[model samples]
Target: MWQNKFETRLELEPRPSRYLLIYQIVLHTLAGAALLLPLILPAGVAFVLLATAGGSLLWQVWRHYREGRGTTRLIWRTDGAWDYQIGVQYWPDLSLLPSTYITRGLIILHLQPVKGRRLYRVLLPDSLPKEQWHLLWLRLRYAGFSEEDVGVKG
Candidate 1:
């Protein structure tokens, strides 16, 4: 017999995905190759291209590290509305989308916000204890999210 009641709050510390790391490596490698093109072109033109690529790579790395450093909190209320906080952003009155996206090591929750773009929160099960992850998964399903959306690996 499973209890219908669930914990009111859950705090998840997400980890960076290895796949994302690999993708970043590939992206930087391609950028590095592009940066070498300045050797064959005019010095001024090549400098601009090199600067642009270098800046883009630095920005991507900074964003990735920042995103992976915070704890995400989910707070559910009896009235059926939920609040999600990640880093400094707060989302209230969120509804779970009907589908969930699960991958090799990640479970993504697609949330519908009351007045903005849909939000996707990624969870790394490997970073959490199995029991805790299972509990969170149960609570999500209990809240009306479906597991039928589990095929895409993004």
Candidate 2:
């Protein structure tokens, strides 16, 4: 209970990250190219595969981010509870799993709802202002992944 208590609540508004979109596109494109550079597949086969993969990736990205699809709200409670909201849907019992990866530039929140499927939310430096981003990173590091909190060793 000691760790859960805090002076003020922390809430964040996460927006779509163009950096992540660009990163995914370039990474996927390079992977597709690499699959062919070794000549594992015939030239014709590789071209077809690469084009198909690239096209699908673009479509998926467009759909996920169109019309502010990636924008969401996150509330961090003093009792160490989290609430997630997107559009008109809200999940009050969404738990932040320990597998989350956080850095100064990025955060991948592995979240699970009490009654629904698990999901991962991407938080990027550009998602918030510099000060808020820093505060979020600090809270995640100390409250979310602290050794005394999550009981992860090594």
Candidate 3:
């Protein structure tokens, strides 16, 4: 049996990648278009939908910016436990292994907390060396997650 000696620490400060910027622009544009639906549909119904969608979009954007602006610290202990902290917020210990989603040059970590799931998006900027990114991924995989837990966007 192979005993794993896992002890690593990583600090990540994600920047806005071009792909992320484009995606955000497209998403906000779609939401803006939905706001015009009141012209076609019943005013009351359209207003409700518009409000819901707009609020949801704004909330998502706010959360994204908040997560991206800070330095996220991840620690993998030899005891097979993980610690994640962003800014002053210390997230609860991950009850379940995280799933990874790769899309448009961004890697998203979907962490299953005690309650629901939370997403941490890492925007891969061109300035970041590919070697470092590979090392980070390898460390994450070695910590326990497997390829089966990864999903790639088409």
Candidate 4:
């Protein structure tokens, strides 16, 4: 779960349908190294890189925790009264042809604060199960976005 707003007493938690645990483990391990490796480096340079990676990792962890705790959601909430959200499912050969792999379907979300316009995008990867993709879409839409509000161009 995740939320964009810190106030208003609202929290959103959205678990990764897949890769959730693996992602957490990898991120935590890298963060741990970043925090620990600086002790061996030459102080000046090591400290910088360590600080950058470790700090980022720590923050990511905090975000993940907050999301899990229903304190935040993945939806981008802007102070400008604008919000936008999108999800993408990478294909098996995403590394080979990054752009054209979503030949079957794509999913996206777009919003225009000034224009009050919302968009939806759905792009299906050949590798993804059609039923799972639909379920994911349904979940996303129920989280406060319209099916037509998300787009896939970007």
Candidate 5:
């Protein structure tokens, strides 16, 4: 008989990616420009409007940056047991959730929030790995959840 050994450590590594840094820089530059546009405009009203828009964009950009920094850590194990820390913005009416896997080892799973009874918009990742998706499916099945409970849109 053959067996596999497992090691627990960060899977994606800790180094910052150049692509991600570049993207962040571009986003901040755009926000800065937006904030500056209002000041450059000739009229007060136009300046005020642009400034407000820029301020909102700047706030959004900063929030996005914080989230990226916070979620930089990824966890994985050689035995296939893995869990990634993920989060979504608040929705007034709806709640979003990601499905989880029960076992570990070379697994991919789809994580999505469950819809709330009330109406609210929830943004979810477009696609997750098929292996994780299947693991989530089996876990849900084992938990006695119906197919409807595991349905992911987006």
Candidate 6:
């Protein structure tokens, strides 16, 4: 769309990650088992307390996951600014930190504002179609490696 423009902004819309879903299921199942482990271990107040603690933790994680933590739509500008949409909320104008990690199999975007908690979005291999993923990966790598980011330096 911006073939005539100097700088290109990127928008990557990846479908929900099945790998992430699987990971979440397995991880939570293991945690739930751990929470129930006390039942099989023995009968004691301490064991019950331990199980309760684990259950509480599991509940918190599950709640967080259910509340808009899966699948992201990311928009990155050439000026090191970015935004993302999680679930139905669009988080805008977050600064993209240089700490972002990009690799062949995965990509992690480190997004944060001037005063707020840091946020991260992880992109797995299956996040997008093969060709799209390849192109996106190339663009990310290129952007990260570019010194000036824009052609004309001010």
The residue-level lDDT of candidate 5 at 113 comes to 28
User: Which candidate wins on TM-score?
Assistant: 2
Each prediction's TM-score against the native? 0.60, 0.77, 0.58, 0.36, 0.30, 0.60
lDDT of candidate model 1 versus the reference: 0.66
Q: Give one digit per residue, the lDDT tens place, for model 3 in 16-65.
A: 46566567758867976867854667878777877887777677677667
Instruction: Estimate, for each residue in 8-84, the C-alpha lDDT of model 6 and write its tens digit.
Output: 77677776566776776676567666656545455576467666666766775575466435656888766657788
Please, what is the whole-model Cα lDDT of each candidate in the order they appear? 0.66, 0.74, 0.58, 0.39, 0.40, 0.66
lDDT of 2 at 20: 76
Better of 1 and 4 by TM-score: 1
Instruction: Report the candidate with higher TM-score, 1 versus 6.
Output: 6
TM-score of 2: 0.77
TM-score of model 1 vs. true structure? 0.60
Superposed model 6: Cα runs more than 4 Å off: 1-6, 29-41, 44-72, 145-154
Error of 1 at 5 (Å): 6.5
lDDT tens string, model 1, 15-52?
A: 65556666777887787787675466887777787788
lDDT of 6 at 134: 81
Q: List runs of model 1 lying over 4 Å from the truth.
A: 1-9, 15-19, 34-51, 68-70, 76-81, 125-130, 137-154
Q: How does model 3 fare in lDDT? A: 0.58
Model 4, runs deviating above 4 Å: 1-13, 16-21, 24-42, 71-108, 115-154
Cα lDDT for residue 126, candidate 6: 86
